[model samples]
Target: MTPRIVILGGGSVGMYTALRLQRRLRRGEAHITLIDVDSYMTYQPFLPEAAAGNLEARHVVVSLRRVLPRCTILNGVVDAIDTSRHEVEFRPHKGPPRRIGYDLLVVCPGSVSRTLPIPGLAENGIGFKTIEEAIHLRNHVLGQMDLAESTQDERIRRQALTFVFVGAGFAGVEALAELEDMAHDACRYYPSIEPADLKWYLVEATDRILPEVGPEMGMWTLEQLRHRGIDVRLRTKLESVKDGRVVLDDGSAFDTDTLVWTAGVKPNPVVARSDLPIDGKGRVRATPFLNVEGYDDVFTAGDCAAVPDLTRPGEFTAPNAQHAVRQARVMADNLLATIRGTRRRPYRHAYAGSVASLGLHKGVAQIYGVKLRGALAWLIHRTYHLTKMPTLNRKVRVLLDWTLALFFRRDITALGALTDPRREFEYAARTTAEPVAHV
Candidate 1:
């Protein structure tokens, strides 16, 4: 009988693992099944651009079925993994949860947005994780501008125009910058609102922003954002957001219609229940070879695995796309080696540094100890991600998006209705339809 191989999470690790495995495995050697909540893999780096209208939303996500033709794709959630039985409880969209057995298990469920218990945050704060949120944020931000333009009440207008982002990390900074740039460009169309009327605030609990970049580059990014009239409040905490009223620990308070939460992410909570050896951070503990500690049959990688950083002794690699992609390749090859009874190699790659896009022609980077700023940094940021983006199909689409963007004015159309396409129809059907006589 062929071995049943089950890979969890269609993220960087799971997708690449299955992709590489499908290419190498002979028919009937093993049955490969990959599962994810989302059918498409989001190129997360381009999310800010998609939010800012620099790239079409569809271009930033790759269809899993189209790319992984050789593997079985299951769109659902894994409720639990029972290592003792080599079975996982899977829950499909329209079916009751069921158990699926596997001979080999690979865990790579990615991270979700880390949020806080602050009041009104759950109700008001929007995350920057999925492409859905990105699109909604774009429409919501522009819609706020429209509200400001038409509102008669000054307080409501002010609240609508005020935008507060509660993190200074890459997602928070880039998202704030891109939307701000787009909003500023959009001000020309609003007769009543000027760019200066918009209030943007970035609140960070730490003194520095973009800490993934070196201290120097982080400081440079701070200065750049501040120079653009953005308020960067460091060493501050968001105390509350009750009723759209943002309260900071520093005794400041304000009302805003938009509050973006991009503080950080914890590893997928599923790791905690996987019956695997996980570290203090709730990440699956793994050997340098990317195998679960003391379990040769089980493998893990990407954000969910705490694989050691070989370059830096006694430390784990950062959970970024750079490391995730590299680790996936090594993990996949190691799995092949295990199947072939060959030697498994350890995964090791030095940190290459970080690059972030601030807006259209604005960015920052520190790659291989070389620092870059402004347009040069922005160009490098685009080039690096473009090369890293999976498949020629997506690469060309994203490239053409940029090429066409050069000749086109920004599209500021608010697609808030995309959030609920059936609202109008439902309302029309309820109000205009003839009444039912026999219920």
Candidate 2:
């Protein structure tokens, strides 16, 4: 019987692991299967652009079946992993949970949206982690414009134009910049909606935005956003958001229909249930080789795994796409070496700086001690992600979107009603049909 290998989480780690494993293993020596909740591997870096209308939403995600033709892909969420029995449990859509046995297990279930226990947050604020949320945000932003333009009441117009975003990191900042740019462009068609009336507020409990890009860059971002008339509040916190009324910790209040939560993410909660050793944040503890400590048969990587950062003593690698992709390669190579009964190498890499987009033709990047701003940074940000995008087809589509965007006006049509198309039908059904002569 061939060595059975099962990799969990179909995000960057799972997909890249399959690709690397197929490259290393030849002639069907090992049977490999990839499992994930969704059939598509989302290129998360493009999510902000997808939400902002910079890239077509469809182009940001790659179909798992199309990319992993050689590997068996299981579509579902993994429930539990029983190392004692070499079996894993999963719950597929509309089916009872089932178990599958495997000789080698790779745990890479990615992270989930990390949220706080603030009042009404779960009920009102939307997360920005998935493609669905991205689409919803786009539609919501555009729909708000429509409401603002059509509303006769001043209060309704003000509420419709007010947009609130929490967490000033890459997700919040880029999303705000992109959506603001789109909304500003969209106002050209709505004579009643003035650009000044559109309020874009970014609330952060920190001192600056884009902390991933270092302090200097982060401060620069704060200044740039303020210059653009964005009400960016630093060292402030959200008190409550019940009933669309946003109350800040510093005694501020606002009523807006939009609230975005992109604060951060915690490791998958499943790690705590497993017998695997976990850190304070509920992440599986692993050596730099990506193998779970005390068990060579079990390996882990990506956001869910707490792989030690050899470059920085006493610190684990931060959860980011660059590290995740690089770690996957090391993980695959180490897995191959383990099967061959050879020595395995540890994973070690240094930070390579960060890049962030600020609307059109504007961005910030600091790479290897070199700082770039404006269109150059934006161009670099785009070019780099384009190269890192999963497949040639997706890369082509994303690039084409950018090329077309250069020549075409921004497309900002609010389709919020799409979220519930049956609303109109239900209302139509309830209302008595207009009396008409028999035909």
Candidate 3:
């Protein structure tokens, strides 16, 4: 009988792994089934660009059906897995739960935002993970500007103009900078709302930001942000955001309607529930070969697995897209090797470097010990990620968007109605059903 290969999640690892497997696997060699709740895989590095209207939302996501048409795509979530029985409990988007059997398993559920319990954080704070969150944030930021500009109430205007972002990691910093730039550019349209009125605050619990880049670059980036008049609160924690009132550990208090959470991410909770052996950090224990420990048939990678770093002894690869993409290649090859009875290579790659875009034409990069800043860094950031982005389809669209930006200004439209698109129709239906008064 042919082997049944089941892949869980459709992020960086799962998507690329399946993409490779489907290409290499012969007819009847193995049956590939990929399970993910979302039908599309989001290229997350461009999420800030998407949010800032640099790239269209649809362009940033690759349709799984389009890319992995050869593999079976199940639009569902894996609730549980009984490794002993070689079965996984799957909960479809809209149906009864069922168990799926497989000969070989690929666990790549990825990570969820690691949020701390601060007062009113859950209600007020939104994460920067999904494409929805990114787009919604864009609308919300622009909407807040609209509210500030139109409002006569001083307190409300103040609150509306103030934007607070917690966790100064890549996600936090990039988002803050992009949105701030957008809002500033938008101020020209709103005569009352000056750029100075927009009070942007970036709060990080640590002393530094963008730890991926070296300390010198990180410090330079910090200086650049502060120079732009952004309030950088290092060694600070969000004490609370109760009722849109922001409080900080540094004894600062303010009111802001916008609070973005980009603290960190941990392994998906479902991993723990599964039978896989997990490390202390709540990730699957993965060997250098990209297979789960003590399980030859079962493999795991990406943020959910603690993959050992061969270059740096006693260290696991950091949970990032860089490592995840590389790991997927090795995992797919090893899976094929296992089936063909061939040699399987261990997943090993030294840190390539980090590149981050601050705003339109501003960025920082450190590629192979060469540190670059400003417009040149920005170009490198776009160039590097453009190549890595899956499919020529998406790459062309992203490039077109950037090219268009060169000639045109950012589309700062706040389409908040997209959030609840059916609201108007539903309201009309409800009102029309009632008896109409004859005039």
| Stretches > 4 Å off in candidate 3 | 429-439
Best by lDDT: 3
Kindly give the stretch of ten consecutive residues in candidate 2 with the minimal lDDT sum.
428-437
lDDT of 3 by residue, 1-439 (tens): 9899999999999999999999999888999999998999999999999999999999999999999988999998889989999999999989899999999999999999998889999999999999999999999999998898899999999999999999888999999999988888999989898888999999999999999888999999999999988999999999999999999999999999999999999998889889899989899999999989999999999999999999999998988889989999999999999999999999999989999999989999998999999999999999989999999999999999989999998888899999999999888988896677899
Clashing pairs in 3: none
lDDT of each: 0.92, 0.88, 0.93
TM-score versus the correct structure, for each prediction: 0.98, 0.96, 0.97
Cα deviation of 422, candidate 2, in Å: 2.7
Clashing pairs in 1: none
Residue 389, candidate 3: Cα error in Å is: 0.6
Better of 2 and 3 by lDDT: 3
Give the TM-score (vs. native) of candidate 1. 0.98
lDDT of 2 by residue, 1-439 (tens): 8888999888999889888998789767788888888998898888888988888888999998888788899988777888889888877877898998898899998999889999999999998889999999999988888887777999888988999999998889988998888888888899998778899999999877898888888888888988887999999999999999999988999999999998988887667667788878889989878999888899999999888999999998888888989999998888888777889999999989888889889899999889888899999999999999998999999999999988998788777887998999889878958854698
At residue 138, give the lDDT of candidate 2. 95
**Full-model lDDT, candidate 2:** 0.88
